[model samples]
Target chain A: MEPFEGKTISWGEHNGVIELSLHRGPCNEIGSETLEELESFAEVLRTSAGNMHTLIIHSVMPAGFCAGADLRELYRRAYQQPRTSGNSIAEVRNFLVRIHAVFNAIDDAPLVTVAAVHGVAFGGGFELALTADLIVADRTARFAFPELRLGLIPGFGGIPRLKRDLGNGIARDMLFTGRSINATKAQTADLVSQVVAEGEALRVAHALASQVGKFDLNAVRAAKKFIKPVPHAELLREIDIFCELFESPAVAAGLRRFVESNSPLPYLP
Target chain B: MRTLAQTTDEILTLAAQQFKVARETLSPNDDFFKTLGIDSLQALSLLTRLENHFHVELPDYELQDVSDFGTLAGRIQARL
Candidate 1:
């Protein structure tokens, strides 16, 4: 498979390991461009699964791995058209469906996957990391689900994936509080497999990928398939619930606050 | 148990070392955002470092309105 270089992301396979890098500036905020590139990457993964043993997803931006979905774009598109009609919600639901398809593809990919995270991985970014079988985080990495502050739950299969990987109580704590947990706490909560020094997540992840790549491909794929089943039904319900909540007046106000705020800590609730 | 002043002093030292600011320059009352010359993401990084240094889980929400080194130390002290 040919290497891909896109505006928001890029991918290339090396030594049977595909390294997909998220590289949008000011942190990779997953907007339409990112989703489109991610969808393409998912397709590539599907086609190249037979040749790949491991997939490593990490960000090249300095601010973090990803700050989550682009709320500014979401707000712009939502209000671009008339709000009197049902078009906004419909459009949002459609986006959710498409994003879910891409996330689900990664979640159930045949090869082992790792998210080498650093800095802020909040909301949709957290969901994206959840797609991986393992998360290797640097000490600077912070994981959060701040969507509740936006009057929305994590629409990108975060709730279901978090529940699948972690305890229900831990999942609820993150969802309900909308707080950011550091790499140490994330490891304690079993969310991160390894916590390396600052700026070392990608290296640690590569080492992990190398280790996994040496194993029998058939056994690795079988173990992944057996242990990691995609929560299709809950993911669908999350989209529905997100769309339902998107129509509320609070989301508009929340998105408006986020988009317009000049505060340095806008990500904070 | 460390007193609040001790905790506050440690926070000042950590913040100074992490941001490479002069240790004496960061006082208890200085707004860390201004004193450290950092933004929110950097602020979160500081929070994580503080949490690790102190071995406590200080939720970001708890520090939403807290911008000074002294108050941050108090929050960490409470957790301790």
Candidate 2:
């Protein structure tokens, strides 16, 4: 398939390995534009599964791999129409559905998938990384599910994926505490497959992709399918919980605080 | 166990080296936000560096009110 270059993301296949780069400025905050590109990419990935052996996702921005869902945009859109009119929750649910579709596509992709993470990967960003079969993090990589700070749970399949990979205890600590963990801590929890030096995540991930490519694609696909099943039921339940929480006054206040804050530590809870 | 003063000195040294500032330029009393000219994201990078150096997990929430090298050291010192 032809390479895609979009406003928020780009992708190209080289030597049977697809490299998807997240490049939106100030760290890739997933917004409508990103969702659209990801949807397109998912479609392409589904159609091109027969040709590729591995998929590597990484960010080109210095700030991080991704900062998570765009709260500013989320706030602006949510309050655009009157909350009493019931359109706000509807819009949020719609966005959640679309994003979940994209993430599920990656989660169940036939080829081996990897996330080359560095810098901040919080909230939905962390959820995105959880979709990967393997995460190769640089020393600078930090992961967290900060959704609880905004009076919401991770809407993009984070809890199920985290529980599936690291079990309930670690998942609960991350979600309940809304704390960020460094690459070393994440590796200790079995979240990261490898932790390389700073600025080396992509290079190491590429090397891994090269190694994965040498294996029989059929065996790889079958193994991935056998070991990794999408948590379809729980993911849907998470969306419902998120939407239920999004309607509360606390979520609005939290999003407002995040969007309007001038504090240097707004990323902190 | 290292003394608090030693931890503070180590933090200052790590901060200087990580941010490429002079070790002598960073004081225990200086607001690292201003001293290092770092925002929250960069501050977290510093926190990660400190955590790795000390082999401790310093939750960002605990550091919410902490801005000075001395206070930051105290937090790490407590965990240590």
On DockQ, the leading prediction is 2
Question: Looking at candidate 2, what is the lDDT of residue A186?
Answer: 96
TM-score of each: 0.96, 0.97
Interface RMSD of 2: 0.8
Model 1 share of native interface contacts: 0.68
DockQ score, prediction 2: 0.79
What tier of docking accuracy does candidate 2 attain? Answer: medium
Clashes of each: 0, 0
Candidate 1 per-residue lDDT, tens place, B1-80, comes to 99999999999998889889889888999998887889888898888888888889998888888998888888899999
**Docking class for candidate 1:** medium
Error of 2 at A114 (Å): 0.3
Error of 1 at A269 (Å): 3.2
Model 2 lDDT per residue over A46-156, tens place: 887687999999999998999999999999999854566668888999999999999999999999999999999998899999999999999899998888888999999
